[model samples]
Target: MNVSLNEVEATAKRAARGAGYPWGLAEEVGKATRWLCAHGIDGTNSLAQLLEQGLAASLKNHRPVEMQSAWAGQGVLCPIITGALLSDRSDLLHAGPIRIQKLAVPVFLLPFVASAARAQNIVITHTCDLFRAATDGDRLEAGQDWPSFSDHTQITLGGQLTTPRPHVTRATPDPACWDTLNRFAHRTYAPATEESRLLGAGAGLSDND
Candidate 1:
């Protein structure tokens, strides 16, 4: 029996939600996996297909174990899981650039890369080509401007420290102009009439008493 990619995607989404990931995050994972599968990453597709097959124990067992290879050991790297791991350990990865070789389902890994970059306050570049990094790194200009993703392959990630503009400080004081206020405060009232004084409260009526 075969299943459509959409169905697999739906199932994966449900499983992710059931497993306790927030709806928004689960949705992100689904989209990431789909992107990876679209890019011909076998692991991404396999995960989708596995989900459609009911998430059997054997399928769960097939999840890729993280190997310390240059590119995930040239096997299918589950981007969904990898992204989760990266998000969890982002602080550690931020200390330096980390590389994964032969990454399976590489597209799925993009969210994790982006999350790590944002968390570490830096940019991330992932690619199969090595020479491009050296040349691009030299040619690339750095500034406070954000990086664009025109090219998907051969990623070169970095951040620019934008120089802040100097602020000008000036000394000033409030202008003096308040004849209206002075008039109001200095205004005097006529002494109360005898009839008014009799009705007035307390001391106003009885100065001597």
Candidate 2:
């Protein structure tokens, strides 16, 4: 059955908690899965269905063997597990972007991608195309009209997107003025007067005997 995004998120969270994942991590998984689904990855829907159907047993058993088989015919990938794997394997995956196809619940996979990117100090570009190509260690150019998060079908490293340059320019404040202000503040303070010095603590006191 088709599921709504909210339902998918809630179900995924519940499943994550039931599966012994921390609440905070479960929450993150929910959001990450939602993002992936929104990007047309079917993450939310797949996760929700998995939760309702109690697919944890399959996942646990499959994890010990070929974890990828968990989603073999179900067309539902677990984003939480995938993300965790990515984070753990960041060192190995850092050389370049990696692509996986036929991922069920693909939306749930984004956090892993993001985390992996961060761990490797690279950027991850996700493409919805059949190839599901991701770019690592690249920079996005800033653009005048920024694209919406959902609009980005392809993921890239640091430079995948760019901010728009403002056409209107404003004059910068003068450095000389700042220097003058600093000089004035310094001048406002006077050397301690004799009277003030006399009253100062330890002015006439000495430790030397």
Candidate 3:
């Protein structure tokens, strides 16, 4: 219910870590989830599903491959890593419009698209009328309409990029999203002992701290 964006981002990060992502990748997932909510996409649900399906653990052999017209991988690809890689590789756009055959959470790729566009000096076009990438990634401007979900996503690069207007009011993730993420994150915590409970975070004025 009406959670803060910071809360959403933090929770997503913790959940990713719980689900076995490295801290760096978990940080990317957190930022991506926050970015998705900023643009009116259901990143919380997307991430929740990604973890629920155990895609993170299943990714031993499902690394992304550059396809004829799309990027594909066995099983489902981690959107956070895929997006990060795509942004870093500025030359991949030369292969024409690229599609991810099965992006577990394509919503997480939007911000990376913007960043990639800036890096490659090109514009990223999607099926929607509202992807607003600010000159600075932190200053992004989200609008009314964002892309809808699908099994696959196609990305086209062209023309000069424009700055999008920032969303006026912040959006909150559904409670179900938080609940699901929390359940996942719970797996990371050790079973609390008496000392762990009473002296949480730092032993609160106790010498043992």
Model 3 lDDT tens row, 1-209:
67678887888899998988888988888887887777666678778877776667766545586666677776667777777887787577787766677665455677787777777765665432224333234444434443433466766666433555454235566788779999878877899887777778666656853
Model 1 lDDT per residue over 1-209, tens place: 23344643454455555444456656766554443333333323334332333322232332335434232422344445556666666675534555554344344455455566666666555443322211111122212111211122333456442332222122111112112212222322356788776677556655784
Q: Among all windows of ten consecutive residues in candidate 1, which has the lowest summed lDDT?
A: 171-180
Candidate closer to the true structure by TM-score (higher is better), 1 or 2: 2
Global lDDT for candidate 1? Answer: 0.41
Q: List the residue pairs that clash in candidate 1.
A: 70-101, 71-100, 71-101, 77-104, 125-155, 125-157, 126-155
lDDT of 1 at 49: 35
- The TM-score of predicted model 1 comes to 0.38
Per-candidate alpha-carbon RMSD to the true structure: 25.4, 19.7, 4.5
- Residue 191, model 3: Cα distance from true site in angstroms: 2.6
Model 1 ranges with Cα > 4 A deviation: 1-12, 15-28, 31-75, 129-209
Assess each prediction's global lDDT (C-alpha) against the native: 0.41, 0.45, 0.69
Query: How well does each candidate superpose onto the true structure, as a TM-score?
Result: 0.38, 0.43, 0.75
Native-to-model Cα distance after best TM-score fit, residue 151 in candidate 2, in Å: 23
Superposition TM-score, candidate 2 onto the true structure:
0.43
List the lowest-lDDT window of 10 residues for candidate 2.
143-152
Candidate 1 RMSD to the correct structure? 25.4
Ranking by TM-score: 3, 2, 1
Per-residue lDDT value at 105 in model 2: 41
Clashing residue pairs for model 3? none
Cα displacement (angstroms), candidate 3, residue 97, comes to 2.3
